[model samples]
Target: MAEIYRVAVHYGNDNGFVEYNLETKTIKVDLAHDEKRREAEEYLAKEHTIAVAQDGIRDFKDQKVNAAQDVESFKLALTRMWEAIDLHVDWSRPA
Candidate 1:
C-alpha cells in the first residue's frame, strides 16, 4: 500500500479534509456536513499560516550572518544564510 498524506482545513461549523495518495498521485476531499464549519476552518487555516510565517521569520533571524570582506563574499554569505534558514524550517505550507 502506498502512503497517504492527509491535510485537514478546518472551518467554522464544518471541515474539509484532503487526502493525497503519494504512490498514485491521487487526491480526495472530504468536506464538512454543513457550510458553517467551512468558514471556521478557513479562518483557522489563515491564522495557522500567519503563525507559521512568523515562526519562520524568527528562525531566519537566528541564523548566523557571516562578515564578508567584499560584495561577492557578502552575497555568498547571504545565500548560505538563506539556505540554512530553509533547512531549519519543516514547512507544512509555504513560509
Candidate 2:
C-alpha cells in the first residue's frame, strides 16, 4: 500500500500554520510566502529528494551491487542527481 501523509507548514516569522492535504500516491506541492517560504520549501524539497535518492542508491548497493557496467552507471546517475539537489540547497538562516 502507498503511504499517505498529512503535512502541516508552520513559519517561525509570525506566519501561521499552512496545512496541505496531499495524496502521497501522486506528487503535490502547496507552498506559500515569498523568499522566506520559498527558501525553506526549496531547501526542504531538495533535501528530501536527495535523501530519497540516496536511499535508493543504498538499496541498490545492499542488493549486491557489483562492478557491472550498469552498476557503475547507476551509481554515477545517483551521484549526479544528489549533487544537483545539493547545488540548489540553501543552508542559511531565513532573513
Candidate 3:
C-alpha cells in the first residue's frame, strides 16, 4: 500500500479548516460557517505556495542526484535531499 501524509491548518472564529494531502497532492478547504470564505481562500493560496516551493526543491535535488558521478556524490545528494525534506515537513506543521 502507498503511504499517505496529511496536514491541516485552521483559522478564524468560524473554524475554517484547510486539509492538505501530500501523497495525493490535493487540498480540501472547509469553511462551512464562513460567510465570506476569506480564510479558506487564504489557506488555499498559502498551500499552493508551499506545494510549488517543495516541488521546486525536489526537482533540484533530483537533478543533483542524477548528475552525481560517483557513489559518494550520490550519497551526498541523497543526504541533502533528506535534510531538505525534513525542514520542509517541519515548516509545514500547524503551530
| lDDT top scorer | 1
How does model 1 score by TM-score? 0.33
Give the lowest summed-lDDT range of ten residues in model 1: 44-53
lDDT of each: 0.36, 0.32, 0.34
Best by TM-score: 1
Structure candidate 2, residue pairs in collision: none
Across residues 3-90, which tens digit of lDDT does each residue of candidate 2 receive? 3332333343333222222323222224355654554434333422222233554553323221112333223322332243322211
* Model 3 lDDT tens row, 1-95: 43323333333333333434444444444555553345333423331211112355455322332212333332233233223322111225552
List the candidate 1 regions with Cα displacement exceeding 4 Å: 33-95
lDDT of model number 2 = 0.32
TM-score of each: 0.33, 0.26, 0.30
Q: Alpha carbon lDDT of residue 56, candidate 2?
A: 52
CA shift of 29, model 2, Å: 4.8
- Show the lowest summed lDDT stretch of 10 residues, model 3: 44-53
- TM-score, cand. 2 vs. native: 0.26
- Candidate 1 lDDT over 27-93, as tens digits, reads 4445555444343233222212111123554553333322222333223332332233221111253
**Residue 15 alpha-carbon offset, candidate 2, angstroms:** 5.0
